[model samples]
Target chain A: MKISAQEEYGLRCLVQLAALPDGASLTLPQIAEREGISTANAGKLMWLLNKAGFVHSTRGTKGGYSLQRPAEDIRLSEIIKVLDEDVLNKHCGSYTGVLDSCVHNGDCGIRPVIIGLHALVENALSQITLAQLVGNESSVDAMFHKVHSIHRTVEPHGV
Target chain B: MKISAQEEYGLRCLVQLAALPDGASLTLPQIAEREGISTANAGKLMWLLNKAGFVHSTRGTKGGYSLQRPAEDIRLSEIIKVLDEDVLNKHCGSYTGVLDSCVHNGDCGIRPVIIGLHALVENALSQITLAQLVGNESSVDAMFHKVHSIHRTVEPHGV
Candidate 1:
């Protein structure tokens, strides 16, 4: 499935926040301009992140948005969950015998498969912290390889 | 993200094939009826699966469709890839200042995130073969939980 625009923009903005120098904040307009999104859209995205407690806003001439805690304390999965609620609930197609009937029904065989997939994805996301996301590209690449290399290595033993 | 109808139906059909008794095949109409899909749609879905070398069919009236290999040898990743080609190539949003001028861009910060995610998902799916899909429900649940548990157990050791 394709990543939604909200996820892409919200995440890029978060990374921008993590990359910010000490005590610095970025305004909605600056975030939109740098992230290639509309100013109005930036305000909406910030509202979401702020509500999730992942971001904090200040008031006054120098006021803007900043991470509520150190980037190291934030989890990428938490940010993603706020930006896309459907990240966990997946709509697998119907499998009961009838399309929409008054009577006939049977076990929906495919639901478990989809559920399993969603769990696998959520689990993977939970393992990745924001520090890993905003880290150097080489380490990020290593994390990617890590997911592939580690899963099967111990599976043979008793996964 | 939602699992596509193609993924759901196609996978269900593959499980049906894997469940078939030795040398026994189910025709398109049989699969369509059993899976609650229309014959026309089932034909199209089968064509995709066949092209991926996951299924084979016979010509006579009694002849029908069956798994191309033992269910244990067929990977779920292969089936999912056949149903949804975009499983591997994710469209993480553009990062270049000029959104439409992406031709000049090298690598966007978000692409690796998506690529890593795709790899993570694929690796998880690769661990599961079709035999596991057609197994008992309890075992199916075990496989799902396995993905979540195995990923993080050893990453801290070296990853």
Candidate 2:
């Protein structure tokens, strides 16, 4: 599986928000200029994030765009789902085959793996709050290590 | 994130091989005809799988190609990794920025989450053997349940 460029840029946008002072927000022009993406593209991403409730816009001079919830409460899954929902949810059973339909259908073993992988990924994404993304270097390092150690512990054990 | 069409088709081709009788193999033409793909493309995938040791070819008149190892030992991670190695390894620390470079290379919070998710996906993939894809319905159902149960068990506990 591949992370789409849209997901990358959208997440980077959220990171920009997380980096701002507690109450400050970035205007559309400022975001586009800083990100080296065109204004139109930035606007599209903002609209998506906005529609998804991750962000909201203000109308006054002091207003622009800011996160709707605390950074710590925002999940990466939300950001990704907003931008690449279909990509993230491609179940194995849905694969169209070269024939009239997939020959495997309900019998494919890979289906469970894909579905299970999706669930695990969704779990990991939900657990990782935006707060973790804004943490200090040591804290972030600890988070990575925690995940890795868990992976190691899980691999050798069988059901 | 999205699984590439190449990864999907290649895996499907392997499934075709897995479904064959123990000593019987499909030739290049037969494989293409069965999968409804171009012969040249099917040949490319077969060559890659052969080089990777997943399949072997017979050079004689009655020979074609068959699995080199037992299907149960051929992990899905091996297949996905072979097809998506570069994508899987794209780290956040290496992300190019809109500016000359990222402002948070050494300390991005999202880096850990991506890496962790990658590990989890890898772990899940490695757990699934190719034999599962060709299993009976109940066996496949059990595989899905096992993965879900593992996810549930893992979520609340911290190391």
Candidate 3:
């Protein structure tokens, strides 16, 4: 399994927006320069985030894009869902062979293992909010560790 | 993130070989038939497995392919490494933008989180051997749960 380029860039741009001051916004050119991506690409990413309700854009000069909600309210899982939905669905259907569904549809050992891993990943992503990522590298790193620690602590034991 | 078709089919094919009696082998047609894939595709997957030393091929009317090592000795991490090395490497390099390396090479919060998640996934894969997947769906599912539970319990807390 691997993270797609769109997901990576989109997340980085989101983190940039999260680090901005309250009510402040970033233009596409500004985001592209800081993130080292093309302005067009940044606009595309922002468009997607906007459509997904993660970000909002204002018109005219002095207007740009900002988070639609508080950074603390936005989860990585939601971002991944918006950016990687097609890829995830394609992954689910890829191993079914030439058939409409998997050959082992009703009884698949591998499927459950994969599904379980997906759940674990989603759980981890859900625990991390954009606010947690809005800091210096060390602080963000620490925040993730803290979030993951609490996540593990409350995991259903022997379930 | 998503699992590639090669990884999926390759793992399923390995599980098929793993379920065989010791010294027993399966022809390309047999594997393809059981997995609902084309014989050519099965042959290609088997070729990769053989090249990676996960399986051995014997050329003869009665001979076919068999596991190179015991199922219990073959971990999922090794399989993924063989199948997805290129994709994983590309994933690492994809988000570096126009620079030769990532702009935040030494101080990237996102990198650490991704790296940490990769380690977590690899650890989980390492804990699961092919033998554990050579059962019915429910039994294999239970095996994964048990393995994951032990894994979580042994995790270094607050580290």
Scored by lDDT, the top model is: 3
lDDT tens readout by residue for model 1, B1-159 = 446778878998888888778888899999999887899999999989888889997888788799888888877778888798764543422322344534215535555667677777677667667777664556666656765666667342113
Query: Can you write out model 3's per-residue Cα lDDT over A91-131, one digit (the tens) per residue?
Result: 54633443246686554557766865665566556656777
Q: Candidate 1, DockQ to 2 decimals?
A: 0.34
lDDT by residue for model 1 over A36-155, one digit each (tens)? 778999999999999989989987888899988887777666777789865454342233323354111345555566677666666666666565656466656666676666666634
Q: TM-score, each model? A: 0.75, 0.79, 0.82
For the predicted complex of model 3, DockQ is 0.27
Please name the candidate that would achieve the greatest TM-score relative to the true structure.
3
Candidate lDDT scores, in order, read 0.71, 0.68, 0.74
Model 3 chain B: worst 10 consecutive residues (lDDT sum):
B150-159
Pick by lDDT: 2 or 3, better one: 3
Fraction of the true interface contacts (Cα pairs closer than 8 Å across chains) found in each model: 0.34, 0.34, 0.25
lDDT of 3 by residue, B1-159 (tens): 777789889999998898999889999999998888999999999999999999999998898999999887888889998888655456556334332455655434477557556655565576567877776456445544654444344322212
Residue pairs with backbone atoms closer than 3 Å in model 3 (clashes): none
